[model samples]
Every structure is written in structure tokens, then in C-alpha cells.
Target: MPDRLAPLTEALLAAARKAGAEAADAMAIDGRSVSVDVRGGALEQADRSEGTEIGLRVLIGRRQACVSASDISARTMAEMAERAVAMAREAPEDATIGLAEPADLARAWDLALLDLADPAPEPGAAELQDDARRAEAAALAVSGISQCQAASASYSRQRVFIAATNGFAGGYSRTSRSTSAVAIAGEGLAMERDWAAESRTYQSDLPSAEEIGRLAGERAAERLGARKPKTGAYPVVFDERIASGLVGHLLAAINGSAIVRGSSWLRDAMGAQVLPRGLSIYENPHRPRISSSRPFDAEGLPTAPRDIVRDGTLKSWTLDLGTARKLGLKSTGSAARGASSPPAPSISNIALTQGDHSRAQLIEAMGTGLVVTSMIGAAINPTTGDYSRGASGFWVENGRISHPVNECTLAGNLRDMLMRITPANDARGHLSHVVPSLLVEGLTLAGA
Candidate 1:
């Protein structure tokens, strides 16, 4: 544990014991991040920040309460712990609230999640500016490219620690870098802008500046003149980037805390078929080269790979210790927490199984369809599986993207969408929710 976190953790535990609490936990996080935005091929904004926070939780005979602060001194911790215990004492007691049992804690796996060493010096401001400029410049250099909207680069690092009275203690750190560009092509009212982004755990993993720029340039150039498609139901294909939203929706629906509160649509659907027969989903905390991979959860519980959905059947609900006890189920080591909040259930790396059809093949099979590239607006009701979102993309005709389309809405029930899932073989590992292009029939598209 970091020297700054250890004493605070001990003080919190002692305070909880003195307050007649059964168990307690504390977590601390310190992080730094920088972002730079370029517009019109010039630097538009640059920002850098760093901060640390501490949180304390106490369980007083089944009633739990939490408090957090950015301060790390002994006096501050003692005050926070005192406040937490006082709040717990006055709160309504819940029989299902408690920490993981000693036996359960003993079963945790040992995994390394953090890289303790300092991150390498990121690309300097000049280098980052050059990278962004180079990307946009390349885009503009492409034939038919006319203008640019924005280009940017960002880097960030985080370190976190969790400690509990029941002998759970852990911490880890990681870094991230990203570069992106957006460019417009053509002129007059027919102009179109397209964008591309590349993110990586290490800077070295990022695609070359030329590659990212060329992709953006080509995408914009290809959409020089576009038109609306005939309004009607059609098979829809979601590119991998946009398709990841479905995975995010699944995570929200299977959250253990939501299940316990009757807020999740999947509350009673475990073990039932939730998707196509060949589809499966798993949460793998140990997967390499993924941003969300971790050795242990936010509550210091050892994490392991587990099937969230198997062969289209819902296998389990993600759980934290509190919710697990309430539901009479075991925790899946999915607990996550911010520095100032209690542990909540969340997925680490959600990996969807790929199928045997390439993106092009899937498009070819569709014959006439809409290929969604981006989504707008938040229009999902996780509690009921209802979803509708504004989308922009290209229209495919006879196995080819015929025109760019905008001002369209895609509406459907999530449950029904999952059941209609037909994946293509164009899976890419660019996002945390790695997924292949998805094809679904009969989606309602509201547009001309």
C-alpha cells in the first residue's frame, strides 16, 4: 500500500471498531490526466490535472454508511470515520448488509493488475501538437478533402488502493493514450465530415499518425455526395465501434445492485436464453492488452474470468458483497468503486464471442441495409430494455455503401435486439466491448 493510504485505512478500521461496527473498508485513489484539442489544424485547448481522494465505510450491525474526502491527514480520516459510523448507527438496519465472510475472502485469487513504475514521459506538447497536425494535414492532403473540424490527443494515468477490516488490501495503476481526427470533404451543402480515433494502453500501441489520418481522410472523401434512403424497415448492421454500445447496455442491465433494487431488466432472467444460440459473453479481468483488465476488484476481492452469458443464456448477475448477500448469491468479484463511493457491481472487460462472417460478407448478405457509424442522444431504458437513438451512417445497397444518411432514428427493445443478433466476422479489439459488426433484421428506421 502507498504510505499515504495505509495509515488512513488503519485509522478508519479502528474508528469503526470503536463505534461498535462489525466491519469497515476504505479506498484511496490518485490520478493525473492531460487532454489537447486541435481545431482548424491549430491547438484549440489543452488541459492537465491531478488529484487524490479517500473514502471510508463502516457497517454498524447491518446498517452501513460511507464518507469520503480529498484530505489524507490523520485528523481528517478520524473525522470522516466518525461521521461514517454515526450515520451507520442512525440508518435503518438491513439484514442483508455486510462484508464478505472470512471463508469467502480466503478464496480470492492472486493477480497482478497494477504497473507500479512511473509511466514513461508522454509525447511532449510539441510532439502531440505535431501528431494532431500531421493527422489533420494528411486528411486535408487526401484527394477531395476540403476542411477539418477537429483533431486531438489525450493521455492519462491512475492509481488506486482498497483496504478492508477483513484482511482485504490491494492497489494498482495504469496509463492510457489516444489520438483522433475528424475531417470534411466536398463543398457546398453536400459536404460530409467523418472521424476516426485510436486508443492504446501504451503510446507505442497507437496506430501511426499517417494511418489514423488516412482513415479519416478516406472516410470523409468517400462520402462526398450522399442522399437519404427509402424509409422502411431494413436489416441494420452496426460497425464494431457503435456495436460496443450494446455491450455497455448489457453491463448496465446485469449490474447486481440494480438487480437487488428491481431496477434491472435481467433481474429474473438468469439462465434463460437472452440472445442467439451461438452468442456468448464473458467478463475477463485478467485479459491482456485490454484497458479494463484488473487483478482484483475495487473492494479488494480477487477477480477471475466468468461467463456472464453463455451460448445465449444469461449465466449470472454481476454482484458486490452487499448485493450478493441480499440476493443470497455469491459475489462474482465484480465490485467497483470510485474514491468517494461505496462498492458497486460493474463489468471489467466484456468480451463477446465472434462469428464466421466478415463485415463485407455481412454487408453483402444484407443486400440493402443501414450501416450505423455513430449514435446521438441517450435513449435507453435499462430497466425495461427499451431503446431508441438518433444515428448517422451510410446506406448499403447491393453489398455496397451507396450513400451517407443522417437524421435517422433506430428504435427497438433491447431484449428483442439481442434475440435478433447476427454477428459478422469483422470483430476488432479496439474497444473495451470488443465486438464484430452486428446484423439485425427489421429495425425501425425513422427517416426518408
Candidate 2:
């Protein structure tokens, strides 16, 4: 920790070029965390947090601002670089802001093949309350659960750092580990809750605690006695533990700041044909132990591997570097930010592109419909790619499934529901999207 983010981004770019700013950028963070919670047999909460933060942005030509702190003295980084160079001298010019062009930054790569930090030794807090009391006693020893309510365990570490005045600077460090459980089932008002979690970056690829309390007591005893189905159009499926939220609504309708604010709906779909002609999605920021692997970006650029849907067209647009200079297009390094704003267009480690049936053969090739599996809220319109939400699970019929239903809703339109997806072949691959278990077909729902 004797780096202090390259001397707090070299004293926040010498206090934004001594406050008259012309260009600037800096970011810093150093974090730490630990959590543990459990219920019914001890410790219901425990937390620990550590800190260090700093941010600055400045600019002035093509105006810019942004400021942040956790007081990294030197008079709070010289009053956060003179209040971000007097708020970028009254901000508001924006010819797509600036920074990032020393031949598009990111000079040199490979952070040990991005295994992203996890050289062990961190756990504690009584080893996260004994991994949340052995994941709430393996979800109350299964058999129609009835309680395990909240069990958790966590750990974290950060360390970021960016820096720029166009010359760029870098930094990295990461670590994580988690475990969760929720369970619950029949009783008053006929209960029924469910949950299960896992996260890793080694903890030897976390997973136990009785495999997250027996998968949260077999998913709350498979939603004990639910019911609702019956209300118009059909075919749904979805569930590969929430099919990467339908490719996260086509990656927020191909964000490039929502296609330069025309409010995306695939913003007139670039190369058109969106999904289902052969699927595809790609992305990949250097995988290795994943967790949205990253090498540069956040304005230091260099994050390779692309294809935002190929074979099915609609490729690219998740830019960054001021939305690729406001759409004159290019910087698909897909920036990202924190420590308080600046740098947008996110997305990292995608995958999708796997299908050879098998989600019970797409539920016997959808001989009936709806399979969902938890979802709620979200209406979504984002410029008319419509879509609704709510949902629950189990209902198939002619091809298996059958019981458990609940609430309902569903609706459709995400460009004709991802042009009638299909996907399946399990997906997971250390997530950060990696979609699968899709199916689709018609939609509408509503219910009972």
C-alpha cells in the first residue's frame, strides 16, 4: 500500500495543472471488505470496510468536471484539484470531451494473463462466520427447508488507479470470494423463498458451504405450491439461472451511451439482424479467472476481442472515450468508471454463442411454454424495444416442468424478442454475462 495510486495520480496532475486545467484525469481507490451474516443459529451481521479514494477530471476545452475524495490530504489533494479546475471553468461545451490519444493509450499488456489477484490469505472474521455457519447449516438440512433466511460470507480487495493527461498510467489488483444462501419454504401464507450464490477469484474457486446450502435448499423446495399460468401467447424458457438477462437486454441496446442518446432500441441496429441467425456475442476482455476481466480501459484503452454479435449481425457499439468521440466511432475499449463518474460505455467479459439444444432439449422443443425462474420489476422501453417483466418459474406442460408459477407478466418486443432466440447448452463459464438457456418463441403472458 505504499504506492497510494502513483502518489495520488501524481498529486492529481499537479493540482490540475495548477488549477487552470487544460486536460486532466486521475482516479484512485484502495479498498477492502469483509462481511458475514447468518440467521437462526448465530451471528446475524458483521461487516468491515476500509478505504481510500480520489478522483479528478478537469479539462476546460470541450469542458469537463468531476471530482471525488476520501481526503488524501495535501489539503485534500489541493481541494480536489481546485474543485476540478473550477468545475471545468463553468462546464458545458462537450464536443465529445477529451483524453486518450497517445496512440490510443494502453501501451503494453498481460497482467500475468489477467488472473486478477487472489494470491490467497485474507478470509478471517472468524473465517467469515464459519462460512456463514456452514451456509446456514446446509440450508436447515434440506427436506422442505423452512428457513435459512439469509446466510452469507464475503471478502474483497480492490486497488485501481488510472491517471492521464493523455500520457496515461495504470494499476490493478482484485480479489473476491463469496457464498450465500436464503432458502425457506411452506408455512404461513405458504412461504417460499430461494437463493444461492457463489463468487470467486480463487478461495479455491469457492462453491462449498454445502454447495451454497444445498442450492438454497433445492431452490426453496422448488417454490413449494405456486400457481398462476394461463393467459395468452406462449413459449418462454429462459432460466440458465436467469439467462444473462436476455443478453442483458442486448447489452443495453448496444450502448455507446445509448447510441449517443437516441435512447437505444438497438439504435437502428447497426449491421441489423440482431441475434438468431447464428447467435454470437463475444467480447472477452482477456478471460483467465474472469470476473469481467480487464487489462486497460477506464480510458487507458487496450481491451481487445470484440464482436458484439457477429454471425447474427448487429456488431459493435459499447464504445467509450466519450462514446467514441460522440460516435465518429472507434474506442471500443469500452471504458468504465468509479470513484465518482467520468468514463462511460461499460461491458466486459461476454460470451454467448453456444447452443446445441439441451435445457431438456429446449423443453421438448417448447411444446407448451414459460419456464422463467425469478425476475421482478423492470418495464423497459428504452425507445420501444418494449418488454415487460415480473415472472417466476415452472409451467412447461406438454414437455415436462408443470407446477410452481406465481405472479407472472412477461410481455415482449426486444426486437421481436431477440429474433426468436434458442441458446441452451448450460452457459456459466465463470460469468460476467456468458448467456445461455434461452428458448423464447412468442411471449405475452400476463396470467390467470
Candidate 3:
């Protein structure tokens, strides 16, 4: 921990104690990031940023309050602490709100979470510009690729530290690298554009510039001369990348805040069948190659693999300390935190169990249906499970992909969709939610 930050934490803790606080904690984060963008084979924009912030939390009797600041001076820390205590004093008391007891802290897991010594790569401006230019140029060289909208690369590094009055202190750091390219195909009145993006925990995992460009070009070229399909109900196939978004939606509905506020459709549905048989979903904080892996959760709760849904049945709801206390249930160790905010429930590396059928079998099983490649715009109602989203993809005919479809909307209730899930073996683990290509029996698609 940085000496400057440690003193700030100490000051906040001291202020809380002086104000008669029962518990207190502070968290700080320092991070830096850079981005580069290229268009028409030219560097268009480049930027870099660095930031640091601290957050303080205090508990007075049964009330709790929190405050945050970018200023880390002793005076600022004391003022933030006083603000937290005063706010706690003014707020209505809640019987279940308090910090985790020292005894509740988990034995430290010797995970290599922080790579502090990893040398930050000095990716030169010329190198970034060249990378983006080469990617865009490669996309333009591909057959059937007529134009490139944009290409870019980004690198970022972040460090975080947490200190609590209950003798819990820890910090970790990670780095990320990403590359992406977008291309448009066809000409005149029929133009289609698509993009491909790749990210990894370390810079070494990034795909070569040529590979990324080729993928983007191929995706766009395939969408050339797209047409709209007839409106009807049919089986739908979701690509792994897009399917992960659906999983994220479901996870949001199962968060502790949603459950406690009665805003989630899954509320009170634990231990009940929520999806089709043979379907399962779980959060694995220890999963390798995932950016969100952690030994402990944001609230200092020990994290372990937990099944959220098993064999079509709801198993548990994600919980933070407050929600767990309120519900009289043990904390699920799913807490997540931002730089200057109280901890909230969040799943890490959600994985959906794959089935026996292969990708070919799954696609073949869809005799005549929409093969959704992308979902555009948000149209999910978490509280009601109602969903409608703009979609784009190719049409499957006679168990084979025919041509791309455009200007379509897929509408369905998530509850009904879950019940109709039939998983395939094409599960991909690149994203946080590793799900297979899913086949839903029937969905309403509106198209011209």
C-alpha cells in the first residue's frame, strides 16, 4: 500500500472512532488507461487518462453512511469521515446494517491477483497508430469489403486497495489489452457493416493485427446484400457473444438489490424451476483467464464457486453484506465495488453448462429460423421479464444459413424464453458468461 493512502485510511478510521462509530472502512483506487483510434487508414484520435479516488464508510449504532473524494489529504479524509458519521447519525436506523466482523473475514487465498511488478508497456504513439492503420488497411484489402468505419486499440492498468477498521487490508492490480476493427461491405443502396473485438487480461493474449482485421472484414462481407425476412414465430439461435448479454440481463435481475426491492421477476423463485431441464448457470470467481476473478468479494467476503441456477431450477440470489443481513441469509460472497461507492452484489465469470450437441448439430437443428448475431438497443424489463430488442443476423433455411436479414425485432418474455432453452456444445469462454449457442423453441420476430 502507498504510504500516502495508508495515512488517509488511518485518518478516516480515527475520525470515525472519535465520532463514536462502531465500524469503519476505506477503499482507494489508482488507475491509468490509453486509447487509440484509426479511421480510413489514419490515426484519428489518441488519449490517455489517470485517476485516483478514495471512499469512506462509517457505522454509528444501527445507521451507516458513506462518502468519497479524489482529494486524499489528511484534512479531506477527516472531513469525509465527519460527513459520513453525521449522515449516519441523521439517517434512520436499520437493525441489520454494519461492517463484517473481524471473525467473518476469510483466510487469505494465495492468488496471484496483483502483478504490481509487471512492467507497464510504453506503447509508443507511432506504434499504436501503425497498428490501427494496418488493421484498417487489412480490412479494406479483404474481398467484398468496401470500406472501414473504424479500427482501434486500447491498453489499461488499474490498482486498488481496501482497508477496514476490523483489521482487513488488501490490494490488487491488473492490466488489460484490446483490439477491434469494423468494416462495411457492398456498395450503393445495399451496405452492411460489422465489427469484431478481442480483449485479454494481459497484452500477450491479444490476437495479431492481421487476424483481428480479417475477422472484421469477413463478418461484414457475409452481411453484404442483406434482406428482411417474413414475420413469424420460429426457433432462434444465439451466438455465444450475444448470448452472454442475455445472461448478464438475467444476472442483473437476480442481484440482491433487485430481490430485496421486489423489482426482480426471479424474486421468491429460488429453489423453483426457472429454466428448462439440463440448463445450469454458476459464478466461478476462481476461473482462469477471466478479468473479474478474485479471492474475496468487495465486502471482504470469501468467494467460491456457487451455483446460481442448477438443472433448470433457481438456486440462490446474489447478495452483499447488507442484503444478506436483511434477508437473514449468509452472504454469498458476490459483492462488487466501484472506486467510491458502497459494495454491491455482482457475479464473477458466469458460466452456463454446455450440452452434448455440437455447433453444427445446433445450427442444423434450426430448420428455418433466425440466427441472431447481434442484439442492438436495450429492451429488457428486469422486473417483468419482458424483452424486445432490435436484432440482426442471417436467416436459416432448410438447416443452412441462407442470407443476412435486416430491420428485425425479436420480442419475448424472458421467463418463457428460459423455459424453451436448449443448449448446444458450441459454448465459448471468451466472455464473462460462457454460454453455448442456445436454441429457443419459438420467438416472435417482426420484420419487413
Q: Pick the candidate with the highest TM-score.
A: 3
Query: What TM-score does candidate 1 reach?
Result: 0.92
Question: Over the stretch 164-204, how does candidate 2's per-residue lDDT look in tens digits?
Answer: 88888888888889888888888898888989998988789
TM-score of each: 0.92, 0.38, 0.94
Could you tell me how far off, in angstroms, the CA of residue 84 lies in candidate 1 after the best superposition?
2.0
Provide the global lDDT of candidate 1 against the true structure.
0.80
Candidate 1 ranges beyond 4 A from true positions: 15-22, 106-119, 186-191
Weakest lDDT window of 10 consecutive positions for candidate 2:
1-10
List of clashing residue pairs for candidate 3: none
Model 3 backbone overlap count: 0
Model 1 per-residue lDDT at 447: 86
Q: What's the ranking of the predictions by TM-score, best on top?
A: 3, 1, 2
Q: What digit string (tens of lDDT, one per residue) describes model 3 on residues 277-383?
A: 77889888876556787778777768888899999898989998889987889889888887566788888878888889875687798899988898889788888
Model 1 root-mean-square deviation: 2.5
How many angstroms is residue 379 displaced in model 3 relative to the true structure, after the best TM-score fit?
2.5
For all predictions, the C-alpha RMSD in Å is: 2.5, 16.4, 2.1
